[model samples]
Target: MTRMIFVNLPVTDLGASMAFYQALGFENNPTFTDETAACMVWSETISVMLLTHDKWRTFTSRPIPPATSSEVMLAISCESREAVDDMNEAAAANGGTADINPLQDLGFMYNRNLADPDGHVWEAMWMDMAAMPTDT
Candidate 1:
């Protein structure tokens, strides 16, 4: 058996959020989708569940922060720096805000952050293990 991760996020507009995620490379799984919720498959082991605010409230009583507030930053790895940049571009071209943080380059690693229309933060990163300096 393998472990899987399902991140549930509250979306004000289900359709727009679905589109936003798709632009960033996730595929919507119709099997778990409905008017109030959509299952976005990032990989076989990672799925992002976008739930409407109404549907989300059913699971928790915590108030959703205003769209301007940052809650959590979900970090995802990419194969190369180009891959990270591409996702950030796609996210901004669609509806998200790109460069929420300055681009970070640490010789062996690179990172960029973006915010979705609903204000969910996603960190796109790339790392080259072979290029990393070894401990003496």
Candidate 2:
């Protein structure tokens, strides 16, 4: 069986959250979408489930954290540095805050962070393994 990961997130507005994710290259999986939740697919093995506060409560009793608090930051790999830049630009243009963290460029690797409207942080990175530094 193929292993898969589903990241579940609690959102205040389901529709707006869906749109925010869609803007970041994730496609809506209608099979798992409904009024209170949406399944956004990033790749074959990865998906994000956006659930409304009420729907989220049904799964857990934990209190929802404020948008300023972060439990985790998700990261995705890009094909190149340009791709990373493009993703950041797209995020900024689509209601997300771009470059939330200091941009990093280590020659072999480049990274930028962005936050969704709901303040979920995501890192867009590109790395060139061949150019990675080696211990002398």
Candidate 3:
């Protein structure tokens, strides 16, 4: 069986977080969603658990850091450069803020950063498989 990845993030508002992710084209998995949390499926292998701050604390002993003070960033890859732009645009329209950095256009790779309503940073990227290195 393939191992799937689940990224749990603490959000100030679950509904708002859900809306933000939905705007970026993710679908919610209602089977695992509830009032305290929502299961957002980005792909077959990638899923994000959006949990309320209080609810999130139940799984961790450490105090939840203020969004402005957090340093961690999540990076998600896309299949094309257009997808990267689309995600960034969606984020901006859905209460999230786009990164201040200039757009990266490296021919084979493109990336843009965005911060959700609670200030969680996410990097939307696209890598060209044609430019990937192959082992002989």
In terms of TM-score, which candidate is strongest?
1
For candidate 1, give the lDDT of residue 67. Answer: 82
How good is model 1 by TM-score? 0.97
Candidate 3 C-alpha error for residue 117, in Å? 0.9
Worst 10 residues of 1 by lDDT: 71-80
Query: lDDT tens digits, residues 1-136, model 1?
Result: 7999999999999999999999999999999999999999999999999999999999999999998998899999888899999999999998999999999999899999999989999999999999999989
Task: Superpose all Cα atoms of candidate 2 onto the true structure and report the RMSD in Å to 1 decimal.
Answer: 1.0
Best by lDDT: 1
What do the candidate models score in CA lDDT, each in turn?
Answer: 0.95, 0.92, 0.89
Per-model TM-score, in order, reads 0.97, 0.95, 0.91
List, in order, the clash count of every candidate structure.
0, 0, 0
The per-residue C-alpha lDDT of model 1 at residue 112 equals 99
The regions of model 3 sitting more than 4 angstroms off are: 132-136
Estimate the TM-score for candidate 3. 0.91
Sorted by lDDT (best first), the order is 1, 2, 3
